[model samples]
Target chain A: MGGDFPRGKSAIAGLATFGVGEAPGFSSMELTARAALLAVEDAGLRIDAIDALFICQPDDFFAGLSFAEYLGLSPRFTDNNRTGGSAFMSHIITAVMMLEAGYIDTALIAYGSNQRTNGGKLATSIKPNSWDAPYRPLFPLSSYALAAARHMHEYGTTREQLAEVAVAARQWANTNPEAFAKGPLSIEECLASRIISSPISVRDCCLVTDGAAAIVLTRTDRARDLPRPVVPVLGAAAATWWNSIAQASDVTTTAAAESGPRAYHAAGIGPADVQTVQLYDAFTINTVLFLEDLGFCPKGEGGRFVSGGTIAPGGTLPVNTNGGGMSYCHPGMYGLFAIVEAARQIRGEAANQLGKIDVALAHGNGGTLSSQATVILGSADTL
Target chain B: MDGMTGGPEAQWRAALADGRFLLQRAISSGTVFFPPRVMEPGTGETDLEWVEATGLGHIYSLTWVSQKPPVPPYNVAIVRLDEGAQLMSRIEGANPETLRIGQRVRAKIGTQDDGAPILLFEPTGH
Candidate 1:
């Protein structure tokens, strides 16, 4: 074992294109379609070459759309899956399975939500249609606020450390032209934003935007003929939690804590070998929690490690080169953006290119921090 | 499939109301269920009954939302009642400002004007 994790495929070639649809640019659907078109163009192929399509599921209230008919996609094998924010990266794992099984030739995965349309006001929080009742959406900010509180109580991590994460994200956003929360964000500002849940302010939450992003994947053979360099899937994994918050073994650790190691082993690489990373940032705490859970640093050291400027621009690993969901465009399934950005940087095409990245890590999660998917990408076509 | 009472909106309101909540289901093949139904979720068993619980449970998990939750930062938690039934409820007694997990919480009963007896949980100060 090179480090600790598993080694992935030697060569599984394919071109995965990502399109961010947000802000002064376009609506969720409009942006999704545009990205699909552009990805096809980037692959030097026609849209018809896309035999399969998977969409990041959006709540009916967010995008005002439901499943079935794939909304505008006419793919021979089109389907939409709604797992959570991690649904985007989870699609990549599914795509790899389809490719290996030879289910279809080319596939495209798209995620779009008019977070701005709903203004992030997801309809009823209570279970709907089912025997479950209804209530205004009482989402993660509060849910996560609880978890963060427990973490602080158990580990004594300071709220200032959490504020640091928000501050860092806004800092990265400043460098990102398309970032929704870009520019300077003071600690006082983060501390001042209306508290959504205990310990979490409005600024602590991700930005809601009307946007859609897509990633196109083809067989290794077909990807070789594409215009831009193709990044291969070295390894992938996923996991889910038990019942509600009460059933979880640990509140601070997310499903990623379980999935990250599995993906690493499958890829035959350890956390230390990952040159760059794309940790899903639904909340700043998630970033720090996964940082430790993914083995980037020791547990509970997430606050200290990050406080030392480890995830910043000049740090050992530069995350969310695209500014991440916190600053970039969350749009619900912000995880997909993480996967796309990792691939871009590995391909040396990222706007915020870091050092020569040989391998990259992309971790995405869904549900109430319930589901997780971890993926590994490489700079070379074949390992 | 059990039907919603008053409506989805009302049921949730009832669920959140004090002493106005009660969920019961017969035990078969093990496991407590809310809203007694004739058919199981996966088995479709036509053997189900509704039974009133003792309405006493331990706080399984607790979270202290800073301000009111986006919806209302009140106490939201899963209480595993003594009767082996777990339900979501808003808690009181402890400050919403300093609630802790694994604390002893007792269910308090009250009635809504609509005559529905609401159930709420509060810290036993233990």
Candidate 2:
């Protein structure tokens, strides 16, 4: 089981976010810079301490080098990897590798988007005008909905089961202060929401938010010396089987099927060791799919597993403690937030804190469930 | 509009314009691919033939689009073609909500906003 596994001695030292929603006229670049500076401050480190930088090219707007120049910081290692929303988690894995290999000491990963303020609906034509354009899929939502419909067809998954996800996310959001949604939601109300696409209601989709998040990662020795609590990396992995949803072998499953087990195996822990989960819930269907694929439940059983509030506040498993994308801020990609929330949970700092979290798993889903990345974090005691 | 003008994309488009659905079949592996590729993904073989698809398949998956359709609600679907390739298209002239997975469908040629020939599917029984 030990073939080129990372030692996972790197830890998240600092985390920060800004411009949660509707940031007036703030550009993505500006919001990103603000968050980067805040992250450095949270780590109690000077701007010069960062030697590596990783940033996402959200919606083809910015690159790592351009952002590095804009931020007026020169770095030795840089990556502008855009694997959809999951890019941040992938960056964390990269940073850990670099840290282990003596390539860099401190790595800062950041993401920012103005999806709401720019009036850019993700449903707009985002793909190249191929032969498939005539089909009018409306991008990701329809792509995801198509998969959801198939899930129903194959497993008899009901629409109410999907609504239960929205309800649970809102229930969690009620306790989070920085979250965009902080109200009560009912299963019946969720079902009554307008259908964006069949089998997917308006409530099923993530919030279109204008926000940014940043985190600082360093060697465990350095992280421990920093002012903030340390959330040590346990294991990380990523995989992608297809880019286009149509080409996926099984629409009901995702790359998480590969990434999840690999990360857990690398961490030397099973699903039973995970105390909390920060799964990317861009859609309710996503949570259901991950719950099954990530080994929380049997395949085709996610519909029943999520029903009856199994993942809600009082449930045995507390997922998406920060409300998740269904109610929390989605911006464009919810990947970074998953890691940020995971770190918060590992440090016992989450607003809606779950009791005695020792090990936390953050699963990031990108594209139409095309790409996936998983990162497991543990507290100092567990490490 | 003949075959020699463009690459795989154009070849498929030209074939579709001629009322034929085209897919790439690797000569060595017998692997068929949709959205027409120049090379086989598995063997990376350039020795591929533009085989005609029967335009017959069942719905592998489908979604009902309730927003911003040129018309009203429409179905965007992935049809697992009889040739063992899958393509993204829509069911033509059928109620999207009524469409079911595994429903048999046949390919139909359609024009895009730019007047490019594209492929769509409709229930075979309809």
Candidate 3:
């Protein structure tokens, strides 16, 4: 993979978003088209300049081809590889490979959903024959709560540690006007919140808002020509261990165990070099798992590492600087938001900008801790 | 084993109706899998057979769906079956939050909303 791009690898040229909250009357296709156009505009390119496209959606009705048709794009390459929340991060790696191979010049990856305003449920309508239907597993959250319970049993992870994740995210969210969580959150309030699942309170879960995001990727040289500061795609990797929680070989450890190290190695750096981390926080346990599996701390010590406001606004490691899914906007699949936030950090344009930041790492978790994708991004100075 | 025609799913479902839990084991590799499948996961061997499990296991993990549910505040659990297979089932007659990991559980035949046979678990102590 290193030899494939000895010099001038792919870089993120533009990033754009739409409707962090309540885009009433906009269908998923409409949201997708608007996001794609905004990304191309941000890239300082015409909509027709895009030669490749990718779209992620919660439903199959709004397919990638339909989005292309709606956007009037006849791109040479297209993909709808939906890996839940990890889809967009996975797309960055796929786009990199295609850009290096000259299969496509400008790749546009976008996602949009009205899951909130549309009143959509995640898996209530899963195929009637699913093994999970009878037991009534509450979509993804229950499965994650179960994993959190196991982690607590094995590592003595306390409920307060989980509440801290929500508190830190709220602190970051309070800084961003676009964040859904409007006020400061206290650990006491987080612990007192209603429990959606045992061991996972409402605060521990992400916001169910409507939103969309997009990114433009091209070769490094091509990115230099774009309007915004070029953020090089230092590294990107993806892994999937299982689709269902019941079948997961090990629930405590996720695919991040594989993708995290691979992404770091591809970037020729390690976790310590990352100034800020944009990790998936669909649930508090997700942050806990990624921190440990990504080697930020010794395995099972994530509870200790995250205590004492370690990941809060002024903490040593600023994670989910844009309030993350917990406090920010989690329209649905949150993978793209991590990349969007990482790019913002690299470009020094984040709403809650951190000091002395050069390298940012974005990690995504999909399904019931089933799929994982890690992306490493750096400022032009690092490039 | 060579003539195993119909997939193991139907057989397993049928066993649930008869108050027995069925698991599939790879005849060659001796690997056990729940929610039975046709071929072994890694080896892709079709030499699979249905075996009656001890219908007993310990809770590996559990969660209470406090939200709207088929039953208010029901317990969902992943039980490590005695046959070395793990599957998700509902536990009856136990406090959701009070349920402890590693507590012993036993399989019991149950019916879903449509009266379709399914596997569930309950605390052996209860």
Best model per TM-score: 2
Please give, for residues A1-383, the per-residue lDDT of candidate 3 as tens digits.
34232222888899888888778889877877787788889889998888898777877644778877888888898888867889888888888999988899999999887877886545123331378767888887888998999999999998899988888999999989888777867889988889887888888999888888899999998889889999899888899998878777678899999998888888888999999999889999999999999989888888888999999989999999999998888887788889999999988889998965789999988888988999999888887
**Model 3 residue B92 lDDT score:** 79
Give a tens-digit lDDT track for model 3, residues B7-123: 577767666777777788988899888768778887789987888798899999989888565657887888888888888888877886467899999878877788878788888
- Candidate with best lDDT: 2
Residue A213 lDDT, candidate 3, scale 0-100: 87
Model 1 error, position A363 (Å):
1.4
Docking class of 1: acceptable
Ranked by TM-score from best down, the candidates are 2, 3, 1
> What C-alpha lDDT values do all the predictions have?
0.66, 0.85, 0.84
Query: Candidate 2 residues A210-320, lDDT tens each?
Result: 888899999998899999988888898999988888998799999998899999988899888998889999899999999898999998999999999889999988899
Worst 10 contiguous positions by lDDT, candidate 3 chain A: A120-129
Q: Candidate 2 i-RMS (Å)?
A: 1.2
**Docking quality (DockQ) for each candidate:** 0.28, 0.79, 0.80
lDDT of 2 at A230: 88
Q: For residues B7-116, what per-residue lDDT tens digits would candidate 1 score against the true structure?
A: 43455455545334454444575555544444554577656544446566776655545444354455666566776655556676566546666677787775546675
Candidate No. with top DockQ: 3
